[model samples]
Target: MGAAWEPGGAGVLALPSGRLVRGRSLRALPPGPPPQFALYLAARPVAPAQWESRWLRWLDFRLPADPGAVADALREAWQRAATERVEIACAGGLGRTGTALACLAVLDGVPPGEAVAFVRERYARRAVETAGQRRFVRRFGGLATNDPSVAE
Candidate 1:
């Protein structure tokens, strides 16, 4: 919670609240100042990098293995984005990273129904690849809030 990303810079996504988070592929990680915190969604254990990071057990082109943990991590990322260089990433970046970014978008006040489209337009054109991933984004607001009324 010590820095902020330049809005519209490189891979950064500017949230509605003016916070920013970068979304990228670990495979082709861009050159830049390292993030203070990152949320990594991957099936295998991710070795820690110099900067802080949290890895969620998630598969490519699919939903997270633990939705609760993902919601928690996304919330952390969203909060950290207020003053830190926050990032969300996965192997391909389009599927898992995009899905996570969509979830974060929802956390930032984007409607769940439009989060996927919002992320695609702002983050990547092909964000949230699979139908299942799309469904996860749609239901993410409920998952984040633990809102039983919102349905799974």
Candidate 2:
């Protein structure tokens, strides 16, 4: 499977495994066809039915997503990114979206401590807002599998 839309520039990061995914705001979806897989993080249930979607019940502009669920979702997203157009989105597309992208970076063999910076450098300068969100990315490697490259 190929991506429905190829990411031209920022908002997309390439993993060490050669998988690519995009991070964006739910309110600022890139112009083109909808992604093959859309992972949404929000306080309330606002996930659209227009595409294959997974909603993590995360509080808007807050830290701490259900760690277990997030790990699972990130793993799934990582695996699917190999063959599908995967997107991670949140309200502002900076906080939660950035955190998730950082986690995915870890899964791609980026050190946990550097994952946030990696995403911010490639995705957005403001990616991964808040100290708690940064901490989450730092500890994400331990919460998930031992091998960051392999998704369970």
Candidate 3:
């Protein structure tokens, strides 16, 4: 029940540490086995899935509403990626999903400044869409994660 995703599979992003996490669009999910765990980024929590999932309050093209929770959820996703099929998803899967993937890159020891690029090169070229999203990824490393503001 803990088989990880195949490295380089569809939507799978291989981190510097070799951990793999998939980023997908909730609206157009890929054809494959369901992830063992998923982190859903949307304005409202998604309906429960066959596998375990955690829904974060995130709006499209915006940073997470709770930075600390984002950190924790990403850490959990990263940890599970070691031995489980973990996926990050949003409605369109480019902005919020990509931003979260970049944050996961940061957690995996890629410098925050380079994390967005890392994800774009490996995941999606147009990832982390907005300036605020990019700013959030840039500051993810230094911020306290709790009570940090990324507005405007």
All candidates: TM-score = 0.93, 0.88, 0.91
TM-score of 2: 0.88
Arrange candidates, best TM-score first.
1, 3, 2
Deviating ranges (above 4 Å) for candidate 3: 144-152
lDDT of 3 by residue, 21-128 (tens): 999999876877889899999999898899999999998877788788888888889899998999999998899999999999988999989999999999999989
Candidate 1 worst ten-residue window by lDDT: 143-152
Candidate 1: which pairs clash? none
Expressed as tens digits, the lDDT of each residue in 10-96 for candidate 1 is 788888888889999888768778899998888997888889899899988777888888888999989888989999989977999
Indicate the residue-level lDDT of 33 in model 2: 67
Best by TM-score: 1
Error of 2 at 71 (Å): 0.5
Give every collision pair in model 3: none
In order, candidate lDDTs are 0.87, 0.82, 0.87
**Candidates sorted by lDDT, descending order?**
3, 1, 2
Which run of 10 residues does model 2 get worst, by summed lDDT? 143-152
